[model samples]
Target chain A: MSNIPEELHYSRSHEWIRRNEDGTVTVGITDHAQDLLGDMVYVELPEPGQRLAAGDECMVVESVKAASDVYSPLSGEVVAVNDQLADTPELVNQDPYGEGWLFTLQPAEEGEPEELMGAESYRKLIESES
Target chain B: MTLKTALYEQHLSLGGRMVDFGGWQMPLHYGSQIEEHHSVRKSAGMFDVSHMMIVDLAGERVREFMRLLLANDVGAEPRPGKAIYSCMLNEQGGVIDDLIVYDRADDGFRMVVNAATRDKDLAWIDRHARSFGVDVQARVDLAMIAAQGPEARERVMRVLGAEAPAGTETLRPFQAAWNDRLFVSRTGYTGEDGFEIILPEEEATGLWQRLHRGGLTPSGLGARDTLRLEAGMNLYGADMDENCTPLESGLAWTVAWDPADREFIGRAPLETQRSIGVTRKLKGLVLEARGVLRSGQRVECGASGEGVITSGSFSPTLGKAIALARMPSAAEGSCRVEIRGKMVDARIVKPPFVRNGKSCLQGSPTDE
Candidate 1:
C-alpha cells in the first residue's frame, strides 16, 4: 500500500498539491506514481513564472524504464521550480512528497484547488488503479 | 490469462514486480533495477530465463537438417558441446528468429529460441524436419537460469554441490559441459563472463534460492534489457523481426558463407542482397548531451539519410545515454537524435559499448 498524506490534495493524474499559508500551492507526484515509474534518471521541471492551464503537460520525469509527462493539476503561474532535481532526480523516488516537490503554483482561481480530490478519494483512486 | 514460468511463485515472494512480456508474466525487477544491474556488473546476479523455449533435435540427419533450415551453416560435422549463435530466416531472407544451437553429441542438437517466436520457430523447424525424419522435441520440462558477471561462476559453483562438473572453471566461452542432468554453458547475453545453466524445472527454484543465499543478486528482465543494450546486443522484436535480415541487424558475422555449396533457407535472396550491397547498417549511438534515448526515436543523419533507434537506454555503466540504430551504410561521422522533439548531438561509434563490465568505446575512460 502507498502512503497517502491525509492533508494533501490530489489530482486524478496523480499530482499532489499542498495549500500554503499565502494561498500558493506546493505540488509533486505521489509516492505511488514514482513507485510505478521506478528509478528516475532525469527530471525536466517547468520554468518559474510560466503560466499553465489545468491539465496542461508542463514537465517530464524520465525513469530508467520510461519517460512520463507531469501535468498541471490546476491552472496557475509557476511560483518556483525544484532545481535540485537537475543533478539528483532520484530524490523523487526517495522522498516524493517532501524534498521531491516539482514546483509551486499561484493558482489562477481560488476555487481551482478545491476541485481536486481529497485524501480519502485519492486513496480509493490508487487502490482501484492497483 | 498470462502464462507463468516455473519460478513465478519465487519471483513474487522475492518482491519481483510482475509485467506481461511476450504473453508470459515475468518479473521486471526484484526491487531496484539499477541496483540489480550494478550487482551483475560488480559481482554476480541470477535471472530466471525459463520463458525461452528450448528444443532438442535428434537424428542421424539432424546436422543436415540444421544446415538447410538456418541461414548460418552448422558446419560439415557437429562438434559436441559447441554452441553456435545463428539466425533462422524465412524464404524471403527475413529473419525468423535469432537462436543459439548447442551440439549435444550423439548426433543431437539443442536449440534455445526467443519466447515470443517459440510457436513460429517450432513450426518452421518441424516443417523442415519432416523431410529429414528428425525429431523436434520441445524441452518444456526444463528451466533456464543465467548467472552473470565477474563473480557469477564462483558463486554458482559454490552452491552447485558435489555433482557439479569438473573442470568447469576452465570451460571456454561458447562451450558447454554437463554434470548429470545439469547443462552449464559458458555463454551469456550480458557481455560478462558467466554461466547459463539448463536443468529440470523441479530443481530450478532450489538452485535459485541457493544462488541467492550464496550472494548472487536476483535480477529481472528490466536490468537484463539495460545490460544487453549496454553490451550492444540485439533484441528479437525491437532490433529485428521477420521483416528484416541479419545482414542489416549487425549479425553478418554470425552468417557462415564458407564451403560455398551450403544452401540454407533465404540463401538466394541473401546472396542477391549481398551482391547488390546493403543500404542500412546497424550502428551504436552515444548521446553527447543530457537526455534519455528510447526506441523508435528518429536519428537525423543530415544528408547521410535518416534512421531510427532500434534500442536505446540510459547506460548505467557509462552514466549517459547509449543506443543502437539502423542507419544508412553510407552514414559516416556523427548524427543528431531527435529526442522529445529536440535534436541532440550523438557520436556514432562501433558497438559492444560495454564489454567485460568495462567501457569498450574510445575517448570515455573506463569506470572502475
Candidate 2:
C-alpha cells in the first residue's frame, strides 16, 4: 500500500497538495506515483511566478524507462520551485513527499484545494488502480 | 493472449513487474531497473531469454542453404561450436532480423532469432530451405538464459559444477560447448564477459533458481535494454527493420561482402549501395542537456539533414541520456534533438558508451 497522509489532498493525476498557513500550497508527486515511475533521472520544474491553469502540464519527471508529465491540480502561480532536483533527481524517489517536493504554489482561488480528492478517496483511487 | 515463459512463475515470485513485450508477458523489472543494470555491470546478473526462438537446420545441403540465407559468411567459421552473428535480409537489402547461428558440425546448424519476428523468420527460412531439402525445425522446447558481467562466468560455472561439459570454462569468445542436454556459449549482448546457456524447457526454472540462489541478480528486459544500448548493440525492430539495411544501421561489420562470388540474398543491392555510398548511417548521441532522449524523436543536424532516433534512453551507466540515431553520413560533431518541442544540444560520439563496467566516452562530461 502507498503512503497517503490524512491531511493531504490528492489529484487524479497523482499530485499531492498540502495547504500551508500562508495560503500557498506545496505540491509533489505521491509516493505511489514515484514507486510506479521507479528511478528518477531528471526533473523539469515550472519556473517561479509562472501561472498555471488546472490540469496544465507544469512539470516533467523522467525516469530511466520513460518521461511523464506532472499536471497542476488547481489554478495557481508557481511561488517556488525545487532547486535540488536539478542535480539530485533521485530525491524524488527517496523522499517524494518531503524533500522531494516539486514546487510551492499560491492558489489563484480560495478553497480550490478542498475541491480535490481527500485522503480516503485518494487511497481508494490508488487501490482501484493497483 | 500473451505467451508465458517457463520462468513466469519464478518472475512473479520474485516481485517482477510484468509487461507485454512482442507477444509474450515478460518481466520488465524485478524491482529497480537501474539497480539491476548496475548489478550486471558491477557483479553478476541473469536474464530469462527463453522467448528468443531457436531454429535447428540439418541435411547435406545445409551449408549451401546458410551461405545463401545469411548476410554474414557462415562458411568463414566452419569450425564446429563457432557462432556467427548476421542479419537476415530481404531481397531489397533491408534487414529482416538479426540472429546468431552456431555451427554444430555434422549435426548441421542452429539459429537463435528474435521472438517478435518468429513467424516471419520461420516462413522466410522454410521457403528458402525447401529447394535445398534442408530440415527446418523450430525448437520451442528449449529455453535460454544469459548470465552477464565480469563475475558472471565464475558464478555460472560454480552453479553448473560437475554437470558442466568439459572445456566449458575455456570456451572462447563466440564459441560454444555443449553435450546432449546443455549448450553453453561464450557470447552475450551485454559488453561483458559471460555465457548464454541454452537447455531444455523443463529445466529452465530450476537453473534460474539455482543461479539466483548462487547470487546472480535476476534482471529483466528493462535492464537488458539499457545494458545492450550502453554496449553499442542494436535492437532488431527499433534500430533496423525491413525498411533499413545493415550497412546503414552500423552493422556493416556483421555483413561479409568478401568472396564476391558468394551470392547471398540482398548481396547485389548491398554492393550497389556500397558503391554508390549510403546517404544516412546510424550514429550515437549523448544529450548535452537535461531530459531523456526517446525513440522517434526528431534529430536536426542543421545543414547535413534530419533523422530520427531509433532507440534512446537514460543510460544508467553514463548517468545521462544516450541514443542510437540514423542520421546523414555528413552529420558529425554535434546535433540538436527536439525533446517535447524544444531543441536540445547533443554531441555525436562513437558508441559503446559503457563497456566492461566503465565509460568508453573520451573526455565526456561524465568521464572520470
Candidate 3:
C-alpha cells in the first residue's frame, strides 16, 4: 500500500497537490504513481512561469521500462520547478512527497483546486484500478 | 489462466511484481529493477529460467538429422558436451527459433529453446525427425536457474555441495557436464562468468533458497533483460522471428557455410541472400542526449530511409540510452532517432556495448 496523506488533494491522473495558505500550491506525483513507474531515471519538469490548464501534461517521468507524462492537477502559472531532479531524478522515487515535489503553481483561480479528489477518494481510485 | 514457472511461489515471496511475459506469469522485478541490474554487474544474481523448454533428442542418425535441421555445423564432429548456439531455420530462410544444442553423442543431444516458441519448435522438429527416427522429448520436469556475475559460480558451488559434477569449475564456456542429478552448464546470457544449473523440479526451490542464502541476489526478468541487452544478445521474438532471417538479425556469424554440401533447411535461401547481398543490417544505437530510448521508436536515416528499434533501454552499465535497430544496410555512421517526437542524436556502433563488465565501443568514455 502506498502512502496517501489525508491533507493532500489528488487527481485521477495521480498528481498530488498541497495548497499553501499564500494561494500557491505544491504539486508532485503521489507515491502510488512513482511506485508503479519504478526507479525513475530522468524527469523533465515544466518551466517556471509557464501557464498550464487543469489537465495539461506538463512534464515527463522516465524509468528504465518506459516514459510517462505527468499531468497538471489544476490550471495555474508555474511559480517554481524542481531543479535538482535533472541530475538526481531518483528523488522522485526516494522522497516523492517532500523534497521530490515537481513544481509549485500559483492557481489561476481559488476554486479550481477544490475540484480534485481528496486522499480517501484517491486511495479508493487506486484500489479500483488494481 | 496464465502458465506459472516452478519458482512462481518463490517469486511472490520475494515481493516480485508479476507481469505476463509471453504466456507465462513472470516477475518483472522484485523491488527496484536498476538495483537488481547493478547487483548482477557488481556482484552476483540468480534468475529462474525453467520456463525455457529443454528438449532431448536421441537417435542413430541424430548427427545427420541436426545437419539438416540447424543452420550451424553442429553435426560434423562428435565432440561430446560441446554446446553449439544456432538458429533453427525454416524452408523459407526465416528463423524458426534460436537454441543451444549440447552434444552428448549417441546417447542423445539436449537442446534448450525459448519458451514462447516451444510448441512451434517442437512441431517443426518432430515433423523433420520422423524420417531420421529421432525422439524429441521435452524436459518439462526439469527446473533451470541462471546464476550470473563475477561471484556467481562460487555462490552456486556452495549450494551444489559435494555432489557437484566433476569438472564443474573447469567446464569451458558453452559446455555442460552432468553429475548425479545435476546438469551444470558454463553458459549464460549475462556477459559474466556463471553457471546455468538444470535440476529436478522438486529440488529447485531448495537450491534457490540455498543460493539466496549464499548471497546470490534473486533477480527477475527486468535485470535479465538489461544484462542481455548490455551484452548485445538477441531476444528471440523481439530481435528476430520466423519472419526475419539470421543474415539480417546480426546472427550471420552463428551460421556456418563451410563444407558447402550440408543442405540445412533455409540453406538455399540464405545462400541466395548471401549472394545477392542483404539489404538490411542490425546496428547498435547510443543516445547522445538525455532521453530514454524504447522499443518501437523510429530511427531516421535521412536519404537512406528509416528503421525501427528492435530493443532499446537505459543501459545501467553505460548510464546512457542504447538500442539495437534493424536499419538499411546503407545506414551508417550516425543518425537522428525520433524519440517521443524529438530528433535526438545517436551514434551507430558494433554492439556488445558492455562485455566482461567493460564497454567495448572505442572512444566511449566508459572504455577508459
Candidate 4:
C-alpha cells in the first residue's frame, strides 16, 4: 500500500497539492506516483514565473526505466521551483511529499485548490487503477 | 498466455516487479534497479536467466555443421568446455540471433540463445542440422543463473561448495566446468568477472536461496539492461535485427573470414558488404547535456547523414545518458541527438564505456 497523507489534496495525474498560508499552493508527486516511476534519475522543472493551465505538462520526471510528464492540476503561475532536484533527483523517490516537492504556484483562481480531489478520493482513484 | 520461469514464485516472494518480456513473465526489478546495477558492478548480483533457450547439438558431423551455421569459427576452440560468442546469420548476412556456443567435448555442443528468438533460432538450426545428421534438442529442464561482479565467483563457489566441479577454480574467461549436476561457465554480459551456472530445474530455487544467503543480490531484467548497456554490450532486438548485418552492427570481429574456403551461411553477403565497405556503423554516444536519450531518437551527424539511436538509456554507472547509435561510418567527433523536440549535443566515444567497475571513457574520474 502507498502512503496517502490525509492533509494533502491530489490530482488525477498523481500530483499532490498542499495549501500554504499565503495563498500559494505547493505541489509534488505522490508516494504512489513515485513508486510507479521507480528510482528517479533526473527532473526537469518548469521555470519560475511561467504560467500553466490546468492539465498542462509542467515537469518531467525521469527514472532508469522511462520518463514521465507531471501535469499541473490547477491553473496557476509558477512562483518557485525545486532546484534540489537538479542534483538529487532521487529525493523524489525518497520523500515524495516533503523534501521532494516539485514547485510552488500562485493560483490564478482562489477556489481551484478546493476543486481538486481530497486524500480519500485520491486514494480511491489510485486503488481503482491498480 | 505468457510463460513463467521456475523462479516466478520466488520473484514474487522477493518483491520483484513482474513484467512481460519476450512472451515470458519475468521480474523487471526487486524494488530498485539502480541499486541492483551497482550491486553487480561493486559486489555480487545474480540474475535468473532461465528464459534463454538452451539447445544441445550431438552428432558425428557436429563440427562441420557448426562451421556452416555460425559466423564465428567454432572450430578455433575444439577444447571441451571452451565457449565462443557468435552471431547466427541469415542468407542475407542479417543477424538471426547472437549466442554462446560451448564445445561439450564427446557429448557434443551446447548453445544458449536469446529467449525472444527461440522459435526462429531453433527452426533455423533444425533446418540446417538435418543435412549434417545432427540431433538438435532443447534443454527446457535446465535453469540458468548468472552471478556477476568482483566478488561473484567467491560467493558462488562458497554457495555451491562440493557440488562445484573440480576444475571450476582454474576456469578462465569463456571457459566452463561441468559435472552431472551443474555446468558453470566463466562468462557474463555485464563485463564483470562471474559464472553463468546451468543446473536442473528442480534445484533452481534451492541454489538461488543459497546464493542469496551467501550475499549474492537477486537482480532483475531492469538492472540487467542498464548493466549490459554500461558495459557496451548489444541487445539482440534493439541493437541489431533481421535487417541489420554483422558488418554494420559492430560485430565484424565475431565473423571469421579465415581459411578462405570456409563457406558459412551468409558468408557471401558479408564478403560482398566488406568488399564495398559498410555504409552505416554502430557507435557509442555520451550525452553532453541533461535529458535522457531514448531508442528511435534521431541523431544528426552533420556532414555524415542522419541516424537513429538503437539503444539508449540513463547510465546509472556513468551518471549520464549513453546510447548505441547506427550512424554513417564516417561520423566522428561531436553529434547532436534529438531529445523531446530539442537537439542536444553528445560526444561519440568508443564502446565499452565502463569495464571492470571503472570508466573506460577518456578524461573520466577513473581515467586518471
Note the DockQ of each predicted structure. 0.87, 0.89, 0.84, 0.86
- Number of clashes recorded per candidate: 0, 0, 0, 0
* Alpha carbon RMSD to native, model 4: 1.3
Q: lDDT for every model?
A: 0.91, 0.93, 0.90, 0.93
lDDT of 2 by residue, B130-230 (tens): 99999999999999999999999999999999888778999999999999889999999889899999999999999999999998999999999999999
- Interface RMSD, model 1, angstroms: 0.6
**lDDT of candidate 3 over B44-144, digit per residue (tens):** 99999989999999988888999999998886778888888999999988999999999987667899999889999999999999999999999999999
CA displacement after TM-score superposition, residue B205 of candidate 3 (Å): 0.2
Question: Scoring model 4 with DockQ, what do you get?
Answer: 0.86
- Cα error, candidate 1, residue A102 (Å): 1.0
- Lowest lDDT sum, 10 consecutive residues, model 1 chain A, at A107-116
Better of 3 and 4 by DockQ: 4
Which 10-residue span in candidate 1 chain B carries the lowest summed lDDT? B161-170
Best by the DockQ measure = 2
lDDT of 3 at B81: 80
lDDT of 3 at A130: 95
